[model samples]
Target: MRILILGTGGMANQHAKHFAAIEGVTLAGGVDVDPARVEAFNQTHGIERGFGSLDAALAWGEFDAIANVTPDSIHHPTTMAALNAGKHVFCEKPLATDYAKAMEMTETAERLGLINMVNLTYRNVAQLQKAREIVQSGQVGTVKHFEASYLQSWLVSKAWGDWRTESQWLWRLSKKHGSNGVLGDIGVHILDFAAYGAGSDFSKVFCRLETFSKAENNKIGEYDLDANDSFAMTAQLENGALGVIHATRWATGHFNELRLRIYGEKGSVEIQHRHDWSKLLTCLGDDIETGTWTEVAVDPVPTNYMRFVEAVRSGQNLEPSFRHATNIQKVLDLATVTDRDRSEHKV
Candidate 1:
C-alpha cells in the first residue's frame, strides 16, 4: 500500500513514521501548503516526493491512499478529493467540522467501495477493547449507566508547550482557524471511547459548552481564542443506558487521560487510559457482592494505522469506519445545537 500524508503538521509525523515502518507500505510523499515544511518532512521521513498542495499531488497520482492529518475543517474537502481520485483514506478524528460534511464523506466512501477509517486513537487502547468485549459478551449484562471523561491540562501546564504563543495550540483555540474547540477537538474521541466501550451508540444528548477566557479579551494576535475549553454532556445510549460524557483542557494535574466506567445489571467495567498506558478493572459475579474491583489483564490490539494498512491491502473496511465516525459527528453537531438552545437533542 502506498500512502500520501495529507498534511505536514505534528500529527503527520506520527503517520509518516508508522506507515514507513509498515513492511508493505510506501511513504509515497507528503502534502502541505508550506513547501519548506513539506520538504523538511520528506527529508525527516526519507520520503522521495512532496507536493505543495493536494491538487498537485492528485495530478501526480502515485499513492494508493491518503493519511488525512489535515485540520478539522479540511478533512471533508481533502477526503472527498481522495475518494474521488479512487484513493482510500484514513482520516483523523471528528471526520469533518460538522455532521453534514461527515455524512457526505461517509456516503462517498461507501458508494465508491473504498476503504475509509477514522483515527479515533483510543480504539487502540487494549483496556477499551477489553471493556467492549466484556460488555458485548454478556458479562456486563444490560448496560444501565456509564461515565466518561477526557481530561487534558495543556492549557494549565507547559507539558505539551505554551499554547499562548504556539500556532499549533492557538489554532485549536480559534474558530476562524478551523477549530471546533475542546468539544470539536477531543470530544469525538471521548464520545467514541464511551460509546464503543459500552458497546452502544448515543441516541440522545444534552450538552453545555464553555469557552473560558485565556487571554485579555480572548484575542491572540490574528487568532480568536473563542473555541470551547470545556463541555459536559448527558447522553442516552441506544441500549437504554444513561451516560455522562465530558471533556476539558482546563483539567489541571492531568496531562492527558480518558476514563470510562460502565455499569450493568450483572457486572461493571472500568477503563483508564492515561498518557499512553491503559488499565482495566472489572466487578463481576461474587466480587460485586463485596464491591470488589479486580484488575483484568488485557492484551494489546492493532492500532488504527496498522488496521488502515491491512484494510487497504485486503480490500476490507474496518471498525471506526467513516460511517461510524459520521454517527459520532452527528452527536457532536447536535451538541452544539443543544448548547445553543440550552436543550436536549435526539440523535
Candidate 2:
C-alpha cells in the first residue's frame, strides 16, 4: 500500500514511521501547509516527495491511502477530500470538531466502500484489549458499573513542555485555533475506554466541563485559552451499566495515564495504561469473595496503524472505524450541550 501522510505535525512522524515499518507499505509523500516542514518531514521519514498543501498532493495522486494527522477541525474536510478521491483514510481521533461533520465523513466513507479508521491510540493497549475480551466472554457476567479517567499534567509541569509558549500546546487550549479543549481532546479516549472495556455503548450522558484560567485574563497572545481543562460525566451504557468518565489536563503528578475499572455481577476487572506500560487485574470466581485481585497476563495486540494497513489490503473495514468514531463524536457533541444547559442528554 502506498500512503500519503497528511499534515507533517508531531503525530505525523508516528504515522510515517509506523507505515514505513510495515513490510509492504510505502511512504510515498507528505503534505503540510509549510513547505519547509513538509520537506523536513519527507527527509526524516525517507519519503520521496512532499507537497505544500493537500490539494497539490491530491492533484499528483500517486498514493493509495492517506494518513490524516491534521488538527481536530481539519479532519472533516481533508478526509472528505481523500474519500472522494477514492483513497482510503486513517484519521486521528475525535474524527471532527463536531458531530455533524463527523457523521458526514462517516457516511461518505461507507457509501464509497472505503477503508476508514480512527487512531484511538488507547485501543492498542493490550490490557484494554484483554479487558474487553474478558467482559465479552462472560467472565465478568453482566457489567453493572465502571469508572474511567484519562489524566495528564501537561498544564501543571514541563514534562511534555511549556504550554504557555509552544504553538503545538497553545493551539489545543484555544477554541479559535480549532481546539475542543480537554473535553474534545482526551475525553474521547476515556469514553471509548469505558465503553469498549465494558463491551457497551453510552446511551445517556450528563457532563460538566470546566475551563480553568491558565494565564492573566486567560489570553495568550493571539490565542484565547478558553478551551475546557477538565470534564466529569455520568453515563448509562447500552448494556445497562452505569459509568463515570472524566479527563483533565490539570491532573498534577501524572504525565499521561488512562485507568478503567469495570464491575460486574460475578467479579470486577481493572485496566491501567500509564505512560507506556499497561497491566490488567481481575477478581473472579472464588477470588471475588476475598476481594483478591490477580494480575492477568496480556499479550500485545496490533496497533491501529497495523490494522489500517491490513484493512486496506483485505478491502474490509475494521474496529474503531469512522462509524464508531461518529458515535463517539455524538456523545462529545451532546456533552457540550449538557454542560451548557446543565442537564443530562440521551445519546
Candidates in order have lDDT scores of 0.94, 0.93
Q: What is the clash tally of candidate 2? A: 0
Clashing pairs in 1: none
Residue 282, candidate 1: Cα error in Å is 0.5
Error at 274, model 2, angstroms: 1.0
Query: What's the TM-score of every candidate structure?
Result: 0.99, 0.99
Candidate 1, residues 1-347: lDDT per residue as tens digits? 78999999999998988888989899999899999999999999999998999999999998899999999999999999999999999999879999889989999999999999999988989899988999999998999999999999999999999999999999999999999999989999999999999988989999999999899999999999999999999999999999899999999999999999999999999999998578899999998899999998987889899999999889999988999999998999999999999999999
Q: Report how far residue 204 has shifted in candidate 2, in Å.
A: 0.5
**What overall lDDT, based on C-alpha atoms, would model 2 receive against the true structure?**
0.93
TM-score of 2: 0.99
